[model samples]
Target: MRSGPTAEPHGDTAEGDTAGRAGALRPRRRLLVLASTFPARPDDGVPAFVLDLARHEAEEFDTVVLTPRVPGAAADEVVDGVRVVRYPYFPRRFEDLADGAILDNLRARRSRVLQVPALLAAQYLAVRRAVRTGGPDVVHAHWTVPQALVATLAAPRVPMVVTTHGGDVYALRAAPLVQLKRWVLRRAAHVTTVNGEMRERLTAWGVPESGTSVVPMGVEPGPAAAARARTARVPGRIVAVGRLVEKKGFAVLLDALRRIDDVPWEVVVVGDGPLRAGLGRRAAGLPVTFAGQLGKDEVLDALASATVVAMPSVPASNGDQEGLPVTLLEAAAVGAAVVASDLPGIRDVVHHDVSGLLVPPGDVDALAAALRRALTDRDGRERWQAGAGRAAEPYTGDRIGARYRAVLRAAAGQHPD
Candidate 1:
């Protein structure tokens, strides 16, 4: 947690730094963040980072968020002290379409050929409007396409930073529409990834190493786990949080649960996604309870009430993975024991047998055995809970907010007036 060299605003040192690197800038700055999918209609967790940024950034910078409205979602206003402007977007019905069949499928593969132009125009228009209204000093866009393209096109004179989350970096690069995303990245003043793995991936894909920053999504202080520790019986309740996707390794967790027939456990998975029904079928006859999706408070409540939080995350067959599930950090913050897969981003957050237990990726028996051990060993659980809670201290939203502030300062320095 050593803070990097203190940002030096102005002069040659500021010429190529991220806005967050410019500490000596004018006291207050205006920032506009463009995200493809932000929290909309209260159930969305996609823009959780934006919400955290706005909350903490408001202390110093004037902030506004421009997010696309998924067809049926409500148009926006301010939520939790952040100014949210949702723009019109086409309904995406085939997001879950399987790879097969028809001329429509072929058209859909080339669909981005059409979708990209429309998205760029809409996002550029929205950014232009925000500039007129707020006179933002920098434009920060999340995800590769549209945000990067729109920000570049609409606010070329304004310094801009683009962040590449999992999808854009891992899935979209080689896609048919990748050239546009590549163009957008090339034009961005700075590019960031949530973890080191992504930074390396993007660099390999041709983004300059100097322009990339690794800034993970931060965790918030959750309910204390010690309060729950007072109770004697544990391993009775288990919790899992994340969208119900193949990459999350939900099926593997189910397989683990089936192997441990003697352990009396009840699982509460707290998120929704396309695989819900498929997972529901796979979980048949197990002591599982799918909570569908829950609010942040609700998910934390589940973690606070649980004995062990299992995060059996694994890199998907197609190479998709997590950038450190904030859920694990939240569980640790609340004093719950963590048992997760040892994978790229996860390895950065979880030290096997130190902060939490780490099992091999996709090993159901290992996951189940770890869970059983964590449940029965009160002393071991207490040790991990205390140590893990302390380990999570640096990841809290407040701490992360401060880190992002530093990054923005650096990014702004790259293009000082």
Candidate 2:
């Protein structure tokens, strides 16, 4: 059976395709992708990088995604030609485990941690059923905690590729979790990390160095059409985009903005999360607009018209940090000046004073100074924008997608011709 561009109900069944003119059905390798967060609908404001990666991999394989189900999402659907199957782990109302932000949800309520067992059990059973039915050549599991653990338990015989985004590597450092991660890493055919620091951490945690690769998430900044000329941009308009979580440092940005009131600037915060109400209260009497959770086009439009893109990311109390923020890369790709915190993952994307200004993390005064400079120095901003565009060249979706495809194929024991 060959998978085609059609939606199928969630079950242990496959659609048969007709033979081609050559009187033979083309055999495509099957891939089962395990992830926690996915777009619930077409217009959902969730990050679409995993969806994009599956779409690109679909070019060379029959890709199927297994993600946690939300209230309004379809049980099964074909998105961008990739088949998606959402598994229900809890009641519609109680399905907060993988909803908006996993880390934030757990941090907001310690009781939410009790949901982890059921979530992992449901995901493992679903993956087992999918593997038995779909018979994928390889299982691609995103995040180490639940997905990789589920894959290791459900489809131990299949070659598995595990990818860690950040939180799983940094935040979940308890002894038992670390031991579980080591067990999963030992079983995986290969492991991929979004940044070099994560790979080093994995090795430090006893994962073999030879089994890991660094593959950062990729973005295709379509064309520079949305990029505005420096003189055409708003003089003092600042834009910040990301989930309104503790790690995003929006509260700190608010403090920095308060200090920089001498400048004629306004900030647009473009995401929604558990901290929205509190962040709004913090932004009171400040020129900050809470444009809650915008679509991609609207975000690009906001970036294009801004004087600077501010991403003051800091380590959350639980040790959660970024894994190379896509927003910073998008800002660079769109020729927007950037002011961000100096951290491991972010440093890989933004070079201090070259592509963008990097300030000490959690320092409101330093962030204020950097933003003031980016807002006032037109020539410097132009130079940084040019350098940023150049720095963003290696991260185009096509290039990164091809690299990932090669790794996946190799892991599945199929080498490219």
Off by over 4 Å in 2: 1-26, 223-232
Q: Give candidate 1 misplaced runs (Cα > 4 Å).
A: 1-27, 41-47, 70-76, 91-120, 173-182, 222-234, 414-417
Which 10 successive residues of model 2 have the least lDDT summed? 14-23
How large an RMSD does model 1 have?
Answer: 6.8
**For this target, which candidate reaches the highest lDDT against the unseen true structure?**
2
Clash pairs, candidate 2, are: none
Give the alpha-carbon lDDT of every model: 0.70, 0.82
Best by TM-score: 2
Error of 1 at 275 (Å): 0.7
lDDT of 1 by residue, 251-354 (tens): 89999988877767889888877678989999998879999777666667788778888899877665667776778777877877888999777777778777
